[model samples]
Target: MSIWWSLHLRREAASVPLARRLLLGTMETAGVDPDISYDLSVALSEACANAVEHGGDTPDGTPQAYRVTAYLDGEKCHIEVTDSGPGFTAPHRAPRPASSDAEGGRGLCLISELADHVQIGNKPGRGGAVVSFDKILKWRKDAPLMAV
Candidate 1:
């Protein structure tokens, strides 16, 4: 069986917690192994943060929203983070942590290393790009995830 979860939230920092909660719930309900759940949570958080930061316009206290989608098959999980402002070129390589003792740009690197597959592309009929990743559930003996 395949399971899906989705959420749309305004482009505010406060919405991050909601996203995290939703992500955690989805992973838990989908039976993701506990050992890898932390990494998935972190990676998904990073992806959503990027979408909220770079992919959307200024907060302005207006009403713009970002979308996150997660789907799980028997042995794999896939996720997509999207914003409403605009789409840009995919990062050839994930941004590296800065040497100035700054904490930034490490999210993509972590996501890339943790997920079995990562893809960035324009969302169909949308104004922004979708940053997506997938992880294979190693603890299960189910068949492979088919691209249906």
Candidate 2:
């Protein structure tokens, strides 16, 4: 069986945890390994946080919202977070590791570390940042919704 979900969330700090919790709950119910779920949740948090922080404003100066989408299919899970920001200056490149003393800028690097594969780019015509990742899943032996 396959499961998927999407959320069009306001770009606010509170939305980050909301997205994380939904992903965690879905993973838990699907019997995904806790460790993997944790890793994905953390990555999702970072992505959402970036959307909240950097998702830019509309021409009218109102904050634009972002979107988070997830899919669990067969033996893999895919997640994508998209924002209305200016987009990455260098598209499709793995971000450089942030300096230890830097206050921020580690999220993309951390996401790349946690997931099996990652793609950072811009949405086709809309022209916003898109961060998508995939992970091969390991299920608990007793996973209630384990894929056959």
Candidate 3:
């Protein structure tokens, strides 16, 4: 089975958890393993938080928003978060191992650790940061396979 959903949210702090909660609820209902669901949820939270922080502004300084997309295909799950901010110019230095006392700069590192694959770049022709990742999904044998 395959499934996918997308959300476009204002660049606000509260939007972070809203996206995570939606992903978690969908995963739980789909019979995804709790451990995998939790890992993905935390990773999603990090991505959303980054978007809220750096979404920047539109050409006319219109309100900015971020987008989150999740896809499940029984064997794997793919997620992406995109922000309307200045995109990376140079390859980002590898995210440093966040220090215990640090309150910032850890999101990318955590996502790297959790996701099987990650790609960070500009949204084609959109001039913003795009962070996309995928994880191998482990589903219960009896879980319903719903085509999405």
- Residue 80 Cα positional deviation in candidate 1, in Å, after optimal superposition: 0.3
Cα RMSD of all models vs. native, in order, equals 4.2, 1.0, 2.4
Question: Total clashing residue pairs per candidate?
Answer: 0, 0, 0
User: Model 1, 13-90: lDDT tens per residue?
Assistant: 888778888877666655566666677788888888877777656557564688988887766778888887677665
Tens-place lDDT digits, model 3, residues 1-148: 6779999999999898899999998988888888899999999999999888888887787759999999988688999999888878877765668899988989999999999998887877968899999999877656676333
Runs of candidate 3 with Cα error greater than 4 angstroms are: 59-62, 99-101, 146-148
Against the reference, the lDDT scores of all candidates come to 0.73, 0.92, 0.87
lDDT of 3 at 119: 88
The residue-by-residue lDDT of candidate 2 on 19-94, one tens digit each, is: 9999999999999999999999999999999999989898998889999999987698999999999897774676
Name the runs in model 1 displaced over 4 angstroms.
58-63, 89-100, 124-126, 139-148
Q: Pairs clashing in candidate 3?
A: none
Candidate closest to the true structure, highest TM-score: 2
Which pairs of residues collide in model 2? none
Per-candidate TM-score against the hidden true structure: 0.77, 0.96, 0.89
Which prediction has more favorable TM-score, 1 or 2?
A: 2
lDDT ranking of the models: 2, 3, 1
Highest lDDT against the true fold, candidate: 2
